[model samples]
Each structure stands twice: as structure tokens, then as C-alpha cells.
Target: MRFSIYLNAQTPGPQEDVGIIQTLARQAVEATRAGFHGVVLTEHHFSGYNTYGDNFMFAAHLASQVPPGTKFSLAVAVPPLHNPMRLAQQCNLLDILTGGELIVGFAAGGSPLEYAGMGRDPGERHAQMAHNLEILEAALAKKPEDPPLEWETAFEHGTLHTRIMPSAFHRQSPAFARATQSDSGAEWAGKKGWYLFSAREKPQALAGRWRLYKQALRAAHAEEVVQDRLDWSMVQKQVYLADTSERAEAEIRERLVLMADNQRRSFGHVKDLRDAAHLKSVVGVSPQNPDEFLDHAMLIGDPASVREQIREYEAAGIRHMAMLFNFGFMTPETADRSMRLFIDEVLPAFTG
Candidate 1:
């Protein structure tokens, strides 16, 4: 099993922005020094949410500081809003900078405003993403195969007589992953033979998605995938460990619930959708009603109990757990305390 720290960049406001970034930089180094092998980030825009902002730049910043072995990933970069050719360029360039330690995931999940603000129609995001993916595949393809690459999309049009510069390590694109909360998306990801990343959801719901992905994955071609990659995939959760369950619950209800309220502010109309339950923005957060959030969304408990909970996931074929140890405006000191304990007592049980 593998564990990674999720840097939830829900900052309070602009006042403490520098402090937050510094804290995250330190946390990344600390996690790498510990047993955690990956650092996960998310992308959002204009919402005052996802405060670290540019995932690409931020990841590069971390790469300079963390050990060479540490991997940097954007769990799901919003493809609908980006020009496909540029996106592909960024991937290969960043992969080179990180010594081929970057893996990218894509999905069409984001708030409607995020699309509208970018002069896009939210309703068309799925189609837009599909179009972008087609172009991206062409952009990432190596030479000696096709004629000059010409592509068109709502936001971009380009003809590549020449190849993307600074070719990725070994002239291959970095390994790709896909994040999905929909049945169709799961099947599509499998057919592409990309890695899978699951958003927070009920265990049963996740299991169903996994089944679809796993079945399709086996039917498709996985040229470089290992058995371990098949088992782990990836899943995200808000996690906290303490000496007692009571203490963990109390702090989560206070901080995480408060974080939910802050998230709601940025979430805006998206929070009111009938099917918003699956929105990655909510992360299964329930404001004021922390018990509901606790029951459904996160992994919160004492170290021993948290270990037991993780055992359930491992038994169910989960080998890589992406855990959010900080978020919702939780103080860095407090978050570090929880993370350090997990590193000391809980992580070894599995990683060892």
C-alpha cells in the first residue's frame, strides 16, 4: 500500500497567503522525508478556493525542494478549460523538469462559474473535454507516424509541423491517470488503459465504479501497468488521527465543518444541484451537521482504529490512499501534529 498527503489549499483569505504556501512547502518536504511517496494537488479558479492556484507552477516549486524520488501529481486537471496543445506541452515539459516523476489525471469536474468565467458553456464541458483529449493524444504522439498535426476546438486551433519541444524522458509522455465519479467516465478511463483516481464517496458506490473500471481495464491493453498499480489505483479522503476517537471527532466537527461552510461560499449555485452529492467540490462535507459528514465522508479516529479502517480498504483492493491531513483553515501546527502522529504510529503498520 502507498500513502500520499493531499495539500488542500483552502486558505482563509489573502492575508495569510504567504504563510500558507510556506507551510505547504515545508509539509511536502516533511511528507517526503517520511514514508509518503507522492504529493497530490487540485486545480480550481476564481473561487478563492484552491488557494495555491496554479497547480503547474506550485508543483514545479515543490519539485525543486523535495527529494528526487518524490512524485508530483495533479489529481484531476480541468481539461475543458485548457487549450489541448498547450496542456500537452505543459505535461511533457514538467515531466522533464521532474525527472519523469509526474503523472497527470483528467476529468470534466468543476463549478459552472469556472467554465463561464473562462467563456465556456458548462453544459458542453464533457464534449469539450472529449475534444480536448483527442487533440491532446495527437499532441503527445511521437514522430514518424503521421502528417502535420492540425487540430481545432472551441478555444484553440493549431497546426504542429514540428513536435512538442523538450520531449519527455525517453520521448514518451508521462503515465496518465483519470479521476471519475461517473459510470461512463470509469468505463472510458478503463478503455484508455489509464490509471484510476476515485473521489470521496460511499464505500459501496466506489466499489461499483471500481468494478466497471477494472472490468474494462482488463479488456483493454495496459502495456506498462504492473499488478500493484491495478490494485492500488487511488482514492482521496479527509483524515485525522489522535489519542482518542472522541478527540478526533470533536476537532473534525469544529474545523472540517467550518471548512465546509467556507467551501460552500465558493461552491455557490453548484452546491444546490440535485446530484451535487457527487461533486468533487463538496468532498462530502456537511456544514453544521458534522455527524453526517463524519459518517459518510472521512477517515477520522485514533491511530489504532484508523489503521483498522485502512485494513478494510486494503482488503477491498485499495493500495494507494490519498489522504487530506490539512484543510478547512486548520492551523498548520495542529495539522502537522496529526500528520506526525500518523507518520509515527499508523503509517508504519502498512508501509513497513
Candidate 2:
């Protein structure tokens, strides 16, 4: 039952691209002040679809600005494209800067171009990613009994034992493996005792994934795991609150339409497999009907109505609900307004 904001930094087409970094940081500060538990920044490259280029570096910069107790997480760090040792070093630095508030989720790079552009084969990405992750996990779990070295000095020493930098506050900050549309990824995560993040699209598909993950966990007798700490999350793409359903519909309709259109444009270009229904279901978005938008993918309405929708998700075993303050290319003013309204009316009900 925690609320976090996912900042895509969605900028409208052909705009100035002005004041974006500052504006996003300001939103993070606002979410902290508004009593949100955390903020997750998504990683995208060359797509022009998301604003964050390097999430770990940006996270390090933002971690300094978050109010007293807010958690900071780079929702998923693409592991296939990084050197395992250097990635570990950067993560350690971020962990220190954030005062141990970082939740690091590693992924096999989702953008095939991100790998192919680097002259890597997409087919071997997962195996390489698994190898890199093993090294990272071992480095994070470093102990006094681990390897030591002696570097040659003027006095003729051998080699230097490289110390793990910026020691984390916990033994190791929690890490998750990004689950795919299928349950195999979820099952792998459960086998490793890591967290799982879900997209709202195809709730039934994600539910099946969760079922396999749970089955794997029980079959393996996972350590330090019970039903409570399965630690799953789902992202809700839109939210709005108003005095009545009528006002809510009026304000949210235009934004949802733009959002749905954006999704269609983005996904239409994605090769291999077009499941419009899955995309529509997950985002809780539909181009055809705004009234029934709430039925599939949103929590827009009066306090009672919004809460009732959230209750269904909560009952579905989603421990964390990530909210996008402004979906599509909505103006920041509108997005901020929605956040304030949600804070005033809807957010309290869930936390309480």
C-alpha cells in the first residue's frame, strides 16, 4: 500500500525542450512534499519517448533534492549494456548519495536497438545480462572474507584490493529483475528472491506470471520469503479526482485521448506482435470511450469511486501502486493540478 510517482518527463512534440530537467526535479520535490513514499524514473535511449537518458546519474543528482524521508529508485537499470564492475561502482555511489534510499532493479535491455547499436547480438543479450548480474550481486554481497589483493608499491608490494565504494547502509540495497510479459521472468526473479514489477496492461497475463512466480517460490522454498514479502508492483497510467464523476470525466477525457493516441503511435512502430487490446487494457486507456476508461485502467472520479477502483487492484496482490501524474503529453500545470487534487482527496484513503 505505497504510492510512488513514475516521471516519464513526457514533452510535447517540437516544443522548446526548455527547463525540462529542473521541471522534473521540481515534480519530484512536490511528490515528496505531497507525502508520496518514492519516485521511480524510467530509462530510455534514442526513443525520444522518455526524458531520462541515464537514470543512475540523474538519480544521484535528484537524490540530493528529495525531502527528508522520501525514497529514490531507478525503477529498472538496463544491465546488458553496462559493465558489471562499473555498474556496481555507480550503484554504490548512488546508494551513498541517497542515504540508502535506492532500490535498484536490473533488466536485460528492452530496447533491442540499444543493444544492436552497441554491436551486440540481441539473441545473446539475456545470457550476458545474467552473467553481469551475477557479478554485480556478488560484489554487492561482498564480505570481509572475500578476495583481497596487494598492489606493487615502491616498497615492492603485489596488487591492490579494490574496495567496494560508497558502502550501502544496508547489507545490500534491494534489487529486482524486470519481469517480461510472460511468467518465465517472474519465475526467475522468484527463484532469486527479487521483487517483480508489473504493467497494468493484461492484468490477467501479469496475474498468471505472479502465479508462476509464487509456485516457483513455494517449490524452491525461497529464503526469507512469505506471502507478505512477495513484493510486487503495478503501474497505473492515469489518475484524476474531482467533485463529481461529471467533472472528472470532463477534465480527464482530453488527456486520456491524447495518451491513447500517443500509445498507438509509439507501439505501432514496435515490430513483431501488436496486441492493441493488451496495450489498451494495461494502460486503462481507450480512444473510443472516456466514460468507461475508469473501468479498465484508471482511478478517476470522486473519492469514493477512486477508492473503490483501487480496492480491486489492492485485492489483486499489488503491494505497490505507481502513478503517473501526467500521462501522454499533458501540460505540467494540468498534471500538477491532478496531483494536488489526488493528494487532497484520493491518496489519503489508500494509505489510511
Candidate 3:
């Protein structure tokens, strides 16, 4: 099994804006030193959901500071809002800078407000993302016999006779994953033989999705490819560890509520049907009990309790878990403290 820290750039207050970046950078370095396999950064725009609008740049900065083996995962770069060619170029540069430790994931972004702000139609995001993926895959192709690249979309129109410059240090593209819901997106990612990432879902639900993804992969690719990539999946969950369950609950309860409230605000404003459907799958209805919510949604407890909870996931055949430790307006100090305790007590049980 592998573990990763999912880093979200918190919305800093005006007075704290300058220092927040440095704080997050330090946290990334700390996570690396704490023996995490990788750091995954989320991307969001215009909303206070996240501050990392350009994850590639932030990842490159972190990569420069960390040792060569520390990997970087771009949780989900929105494809519809970017020019495919330029995005490929930036990814290549990041891969080179990180010594091939880059892992890229793409998604049709969920926020209608974000799409509106970018002068795009949120309803068309899936279609646009499909086209963008084609172009991106073509731009990153390394084989001489790969098909010629051609793209004609609202965001870009070009044909590349030559492969992208600064080829990835890896034999193929560094690594490609897709952020998928329990939707057609999972099947599409499986067809492409890409990795899978899901968030805020139960083990049973994720296991079902993984089964679907594997079935699709077998139908779309050779058996060898299917076998090699079947287990390259990750699930994300909010996690906080402390000396006691009571302490963990007291520390994270208010923040968890705040995080849910933030999601309500963002998802409540959805006007597009597609975004509404996505909101239904991700946020569902508002919760009445904070304790119940924490019990169901997050991993918050003492080291032994958290370890037991993670063991359930391992039993369900989950090989990678992305822990969202710095979320819901958590202070840097608290997040760091939780991470250190987890590293000291809980992580070794899994690693050893």
C-alpha cells in the first residue's frame, strides 16, 4: 500500500496571503520527510474551495525543494478551461523538473461558477474534456508509430507533426490519472488505461466503481495492460489523528462543519443540470448531526482507532489512500501536529 498527503491551498486572509504559500510549501516538504509517497494538490478557481489555480507551477516549486524521489500528484486539472497543447507543455516541463515524479489527473470541473467566470458553458464540460483529452494524449505521445496529432476545438486548433519537446524522463508520459465519480467518467478512464481517483466515497461504493473500471479496461486494452494498471487507484478522505478520540473530535468537529458549509455554498449555487447531477453525487443533502457526519465521512480518532479504520480499507483492497489533513480552515500548526503524530504512531504499522 501507498500513502499520500492531499494538500489544499486554503483561502488566506488578506493579512496572511503572503505567508500562506510559504506555509504550504513547508508542509509539503514536511510531508515528504515524514515518509509519504507523494503530495497531491487540488485545483480550484474563483471559489474559496482551494487557492491552487495553477497546480503545475506550485508542484514544480515543491519539487525543487524536495528530494528527487518525492512524487507530485496533480489531483485534477480541469481540462475544459485549458488549451490542451499548452497544458501538455507545462506538464512536460513539470515532469522534467521533478525528475519524472509527476502524476497528472484530469477532470471536467464541477463548479458552474468557475466555468461561467472562464466564459465557458458548464454543461459542455464533459464533451470539451473528451476532446481535450484526445489532444493532450496525442501531444504527449512518445512512440514513432503513434497516430498523427490533430486538434480543432474552441480552445485550440492545430496539428503536430513532431512530438512534444522535453520528453518525459519516464519511458512514456510520466503518469496519467483521471478524477472520476460513479459515472461514465470511470468507464472512460478505464478505457484509456489511466489511473483512478475518487473522493468522499465509501469503500463499498469505491469497490463497485473499481470493478466497473476493471471490466472496462479489460474490454478496451490488452490483458497485460489491464493487469499492470488495475491497482493504480486512490481514494481520498479527511483524516485527523490525536492522542484520544475525544481530542480528535473536539479539534476537527467545528472545522468539519465549516467545510461542509463551504461545500453547501459552492454546490447550492449550481444552475446547470450537469453540475446539479454532480452535486447530488458528491455533496448529497445537508447533515443534521456533526458527530454522525464525522463518523461516516472522516477518519478522526486516536492512532489505534485510525489504524483500525484504515485496516478496513486495506481489507477492501484499497492500495493507496490520500489523506486530506489540511482542510476546513485548519491551522498550519494543527495540521502539522496531526501529521507528525500519524507518522509516528499509525504509518509505521502499515509501512512495516
Candidate 4:
């Protein structure tokens, strides 16, 4: 399996945000040097959910520093928020910059505030995303001689008379991935022979998603596409490494609670993850209750145990693991220690 770091940082307040963002940037450089195969980023805006709101620009900056082999994924970007032409141009340019080592994942959904900030209606996001994506595909496929497109939407409309300049480095346009928590990720992306990923899911439970996607791909695509797309599937986790499980748990205990409280305040008890009542009944842990959330949502242990957890994920068809080392108000220095330990001890078990 190939492992990568998911570069996401939390903001406790405006006071602490700047330092976290700087740390996150340095962590990207450190991770590439530490021998991770790739890196993943998510696009979040307005709420400080991601320390940086501009993933495309951040990725371009990273491409200059990370090793040539260090691939990148936008794991996702919200399509409805961008002008289609600009979005297409940005994706193609970034793809060229990465030497075609880019996967542009997209989803229709985003936070309501983000939609509002972009002057897009949340209720119309799906339609808007579809419209934007169609334009993007058309723009990517356009040749200089092609006729102009006349596009209109609720918010804006324009004509595109020329092909998107500086075409993608890849011959067949950039590889596309979809981000979704529902079966649609497989039903659409799988059948279309595209990559798909999800987060906040149990690694073991992802076996179901894997099976469904494989079934869908086998039914719709040729052998080469099926074989190539089948491997390198992604799984995300929050990771912390220590000499012993006891030490790992004790070190992360308070931080997890603080993170959970943010989730409760930001997302209203994180009902989307699961309400307190159902979470307690099914998993014996509330969404904001960090006591057992650590066990369920994170990968925390000694190097040996961490390696074993990764092995389980591999058996379940996860070839790409995107781990988050800094989270829940954790210090950069502390997270880097875990990352370096992972590189020196745990990674060799998998990589070598």
C-alpha cells in the first residue's frame, strides 16, 4: 500500500490560526522528505475548517518543494463555488505543474456559508456543480478551432470562444476522483471508471464500499481500467505514534476532547457524524465524546500496532492511506515527532 499525509489543520481561534497554517506548510515539506508517496488536501472555506482556503495555490507552492515523485490529490474541491472556465484553467495548470501527478476530485456539496460567500445558493449546488463540471469537461476537451460555448446559470453566464490555454500535462486530461459518503461515489465514479474516496469511515467497514465499487467497475469498464483503478484506493485516519499504546492514549486524551468540543459547537453536536443517542447505542460513544472517539476515529498506538492497523486496511482493499498527524489542538512539534517515528519505524514495515 502507498501511504500519504492528509494536510489538514484545525483553528481554535483567530489568535492561533496563523501559527497552525505556517506549521501545516512546513509539515508538507517535512512529509515529502520523510518518504511519503503522496499528499492529499481538502478544500474548505470561510469556517477555518482548513487553515488555508486556497488549495490550488497552496498545492502549486507545494509542488515546487515536494519531491518529484510526491503526488497530490485535491481529495475534494467544491465545484459550484468556482467559475467553470477559471476552474478548468486552474486544474489544467496545476496538473501541468505537478507533471500530471494530480487527481482532481470534486463534489457538489459544501457548507452553506461557503455557498453564500461564493454567491451560490446551497439549494442549487448540485445543479450548479453539474453545470460547472460539464463546462470544465467541455473546456478541457475543446480545441482552438471549436465553436464557442454559450452557458448560463442562475448566478452568471458567459461565452467561451477559445480552448483553455496550457492544456493539462496528461494526455487524456487529469485523472478525476469523486468525494462522497454515499453509494453514489461507486455508482457514478466506479461505473465511469474514476477513482473515489471517503473519510470518517471505519477502515473495516470500507470493505463494503470497495466491494460495491469493484462490482460497479467490473460491470461497466474494460479490464485495464478496472485493474488500474482497483488498487490505490484511499483511506483517511488521524494518527499518533508512541513507544507504547498507554503513552499514546494518555498524550492524546485531552486534545481529542477539545477537538470534539469544536465539532459540537461548529456542527451542532456533529449530528451528521451521528447524534449522541444513536452513537452511544451503536458505538457506545457520542460524536463529541472523545473518550471512545479516539478508538473509533483515530490510529493511535506503538509502531508495531500501527503497522498492524495498516495491514488490516490493506486487506480491506485500501492501498492508499492518508493520515492526519496534526489535529485537535496538537502541537506541531509533537505531531512531527509522531510523523518522524512513523517514518523511521512504522513506514519501513510497509514500504520496505
Candidate 5:
């Protein structure tokens, strides 16, 4: 199983503005030294979610400083907000800098606020996202002879044939889609025969999504994905560790509450994640007690306990587990401690 920490400062508010870069860099160094596989940063726009919205840029900067073995990735990027050519170039450059360790997670720019902030119409985002994705894929594939560019033609007085820069890593790096809620991600992942890194904290929802993914793959006739393809990871994330179950419960409460509240506010108005009728249920399932959430969403507890949980997920076909242990007010110290505990105790039990 592969383990990676999702990098983000606990809270970016005035009270806790120590910044994630310093802590994340330190954590990355520790993770690499400790033998963890990778670190993934998330991208968000115009939200207090994380002060650092440019995940690709941040990942690149961090990648340069990380220890030798640790890799870096952007969990998801708002595709419509970026020019595909420029985005591809930047990603390629990052991949080169990281020695070909880059896994791109593309998304259709969630959050209407991000779209509104960018002056993009939310209704047209999916189509626009599809267009941008095609351009990016074509650029990465080095299909330069392919033409009929619409977005570029409108901007040019005449004709402009532009190819992205630093395309060296185009053939080396792989890409994935962040499947959130809808089957759009599975459908697209299958359509492109690309990998899908599906993340769900909820087991039931995750099972449903996994089924949907298989269905989509079957529909698209996607070939058996290669394990070497970083994008094709079967990742199931949780906020868990090994200790007495009672002790685990005591440790994760406050942090979970803060995280759930932040989530409720972040996507509060976004109907895609939660409908009016289902909003309370969403929060209800989002454990007010971090340990309870851990029992359900995270893979934390005693060694025997966590092992059993992992076995269930492995049975469900999850090979890579992206454990989200550091969230809310989780200090870098605690986060590091959790990683150590998981590595030393919980990790050994599951070698599948």
C-alpha cells in the first residue's frame, strides 16, 4: 500500500496563519526520510480554504526542497481557470524538476464562487472543461499537427499556431481525474482510458463510486490500467492510526469538528456535494468526533483494529491508501507523530 499526506495548513485564518509551506516542507522531508511514498497538495480559488491556491506552483517549489525519495503531486486543479498550453508547460517543467514524478489531477473547477471569481459561467464550465482537457491532452501527447483551435482563434487577429514549452516530460508523466460525487470523473477517466484517483471518506459512498467506476470503464472499454500509472492508484483515504480504540477516540475529536465545520461552509451552497434534504445527513455522517470519523472514514486504531479495516478495503480492491491524518488544528508535531505511528505499527500489517 502507498501512503501520502494531503498537505494543507490546519486553518488559514488570522488565528492560525503560521503557513503550510514551512510545515509542509518539513513534513515532506520527514515523510521521505521515513519512507512514505508521496505528498499531494490541493488547489482551491477565492476561498479561505487554503491560502495557497496555486497547488502546481507550490508543489513544484516543495518538490525542489523535498528529500530524495518523496514525490509530489497536485490532487486536483481547476482546469477551466488555466490556459491548457501554459498549464501543460508548467506541469511538464514540474515533472522534469521532480525527475518525472508528477501525477496531474484534473477537475472541472468545483465551487461556483471560484468560477464567478474567474468571471466564468458555471453552467458552461463542464463543456469548457472538456475543451480545455482535450487541448491539454493533445499538447501532452505532442499531437502538434492537430488543429482547429477555437479559443485561440477568437483571441488572435490572424492565425496562431502555438505549442507549449518544456514538453520534455509529456510522454513520461501520467494524469488522473478527481472523481467527486458525480460519475463525470469515472466517465471521463474511462473515456480517456486514463486513471482515476477516487477519494471518498464515506465507505458506502465509496463503494457506490467504485461500482460506478467499473461500470464506466466497461462502457468505455478501457484497458486494464497499469499499476505503474500513478493516476491509476486505488486510493481510499481515512484519518486513522494504531493505539487503543478508546485512546484513538480521545485524540481526534476537536480536529474533526473543525474540519467538518470548514467543509460544511466550503461547499455549503454547492448542491453537488450535498442537497438541501441531504445536507444534515452529510454533516451527521461527518463525525463530530474525529475518532468516530476515524472508525468510519479513517483507518486509525490499534494495530489489529486498523489491520482488519484495511483488509476490508483491500477486499474492496483498494491498494493505495491516502490517509488524511493532519487536518483542522492538527499541529505539525502531531501530524508527524501520526505518520510515525502509522509507519511503525499499522503499515507493516498490510503488504498486499
Candidate 6:
């Protein structure tokens, strides 16, 4: 099993932005020293849900400071909001800067407010994301002889002939992963040989999705493609460790509720019940008690208890666990303590 820090960088308000970035940077350095595999940065905008509006740029900056071996995972970049050529160029530069330590995750963003703010239609995001991804892949794979990529869309229309200079340090390109909720998304990812990114579902539900993904992979490709098993598939979860379970609850319980409320406010406009259910499964509903909230949704407890929870995920065939240690309005000191405790007590158990 491999562990990665999912950097939320959430603060109480803009007043604390600088402090939050410093704290996240400190933690990233500490995580590298502590033998963690990588760090995952999120992308969000126009809300307190997260503060990183341009995770790729932030990632590039952070990657320069972290150790050469520390990898970067873009949890999910919203491609529809970006020009595919520009996005690919920036990603390639980041990959080179990190010494090939980059993994790109793509997703059709969920927040309607964010879409509206960007002057884009939320309903058209899926198709737009698919199209952008196609262009991005082609741009990355383009050679000097290849013709310019020509396309027309509501947001962008032009011919892009410039190749991504200093092409990705990786032999091919950074490993590609896609965040998926529906069966079709899983099938698409599998057929394209991309890794899967999922969270919030129970182990049984995740197992079913993996099965479907594999079936699609087998259907679309040969036996060799289906036979390769890597731990690239990942799941993200909010995790906080303390000396005791009670302490962990006390530190993060209230903030968890606030986080849930923020989620509700941001995504409450979706009229479709199925979409609502999916959102609920991922973001979760507000819980009456801390235990109920942490039971299946998060990993919050003492080191021993947290170890047991991770064992369940490992058994479920999930090897990459993106752990979010800071969220909501939790203080940086509290987040730092939890991370240190996790590094000293919990991480060694798995790594050793």
C-alpha cells in the first residue's frame, strides 16, 4: 500500500490564505521526509470548499521545493474550463520540473456555481470535458510533423500548432486517471486504459465498480491489458489521527458538519434525484453524531483504530489512499499534530 497527502489548503477566510499555503508547504516537505509516496492537490474556485483555484500552478511551485523523489498527483483538474493546449503545456512543464513525478486526474466538475462563474453551462460539462481530454491527449502526443490541432468551441476557437516544449519527462506522458461516478464513466476510463479515482462509496460498492471497469477493459483491449494490475486506482478520504479516538472527534467533529453544510449549499441546485444521490454519496449528509459521520465516511481515530480502517481499504484492492488531513476550518496546529501522529504511529505500521 502507498499513502499520499490530499492537500485541501482550506482556511477560515482570505485573511488566512498565506498562512494556509505555508502550512501546506511545510506539511508537504514533512511528508516527503516521512517517506510518504506523494501529495495530491485539489482544484476548486469561487467558494470556500477549497482555496486552490489553479492547482497546476500551485503544484508546479510546490514541486520545485519538495524533494526530487516526492511525486505530485492532481486529484482532478477541470479541463473544460481550460484550453486543452495550454493545459497540456503547463502539465508537461510541471512534469519536467518534478523530474517525471506527475500524475494527472481529470473530471467533469460538479459545482454549478463554479461553472456559472466561469460562464459555462454545467449541463454541457461532460461532453466538453470529453472533448477537451481528447485534445489534451493529442496535444501531448503530437510530434513536430503533426498538423496543428484545429477546433471550435464556445470558449475557444483556433489552430494550435506549437508542440509542448520540454515534453513530459515520462516515457509516454504522466499517468492518466479519471474520477468517475456512473457506470458509463467507469467503462470509458477502462476502455481508454486510464486509472480510476473514486471515493465516498462503501467497499462493496467500490468493488462492484472495479469489476465493471475491468470487464470493460477486457472487452475493449486484449488479455495483456486486462492482466496488468497496478495500484494506480485511488480513493480519497478525510483522515485525522490523534492519541485517542475521543481527541480526534473533539478536534474535527464540528468542522466536519460545517464542511457538509458547505457542500450542501454548493451542490444543492441539482434537480435530478440520481445526481443528488450520487452527490450525497460522495459529499455525504450532515451527521447527528461524530461517530456516525466517521463510521464509513472518514478515517478518524487513534493509530490502532485507523490502521484497522485502512486494512479494510487494502482488502478492497485499493492501494493508493489519498488522505485529507486538513479541511473545513480546522486550525493548522491541529492538522499538523494529526499529520505528525499519523506519520509516526500509523504510517510505519503499513510501510514496515
Task: Tell me each candidate's TM-score.
Answer: 0.90, 0.76, 0.87, 0.88, 0.78, 0.88
lDDT ranking from best candidate downward: 6, 4, 1, 3, 2, 5
Compared with the true structure, the alpha-carbon lDDT of candidate 4 equals 0.77
User: Worst 10-residue stretch by lDDT in candidate 1?
Assistant: 274-283
Which whole-number lDDT from 0 to 100 does residue 235 have in model 2?
A: 45
Query: Tens digit of lDDT per residue, candidate 3, span 192-257?
Result: 788888776666777778788888989989998876565457877789888899999897877867
Query: Any runs in candidate 2 off by more than 4 Å, and if so which?
Result: 13-18, 112-124, 141-163, 172-174, 202-228, 231-236, 241-298
> Runs in model 6 with CA error above 4 Å?
215-229, 264-293
List the pairs of residues colliding in candidate 5: 238-298, 239-298, 240-300, 241-300, 241-301
lDDT measured at residue 328 in model 5 versus the true structure, 0 to 100 = 64
Pairwise TM-score winner, candidates 4 and 5: 4
Q: Give the TM-score of candidate 1.
A: 0.90
The backbone clash count of each candidate, in order, is 0, 8, 0, 0, 5, 0
RMSD of model 6 against the true structure: 3.3
Candidate 2 local lDDT, 1-352, one digit each (tens)? 7888877765555353455556777888888777888888777665445665688887877777877556665667777677665677788787777777667776654444344445454456567777667666766666656686332211123322555565676656444445454567778767766666655443455556677877777776645573633643444445777778778778778776775565556545544432322333322235456556655556677777877776766666666777777655666777777778778777788766
Model 2, poorest ten-residue lDDT window? Answer: 151-160
User: TM-score: which candidate is best?
Assistant: 1
Give each prediction's root-mean-square deviation over alpha carbons: 2.9, 6.6, 3.2, 4.0, 4.6, 3.3
Show the colliding residue pairs in model 4. none
lDDT of 2: 0.64
**Model 4 TM-score?**
0.88
Q: Give residue 50's lDDT in candidate 1 (0 to 100).
A: 69
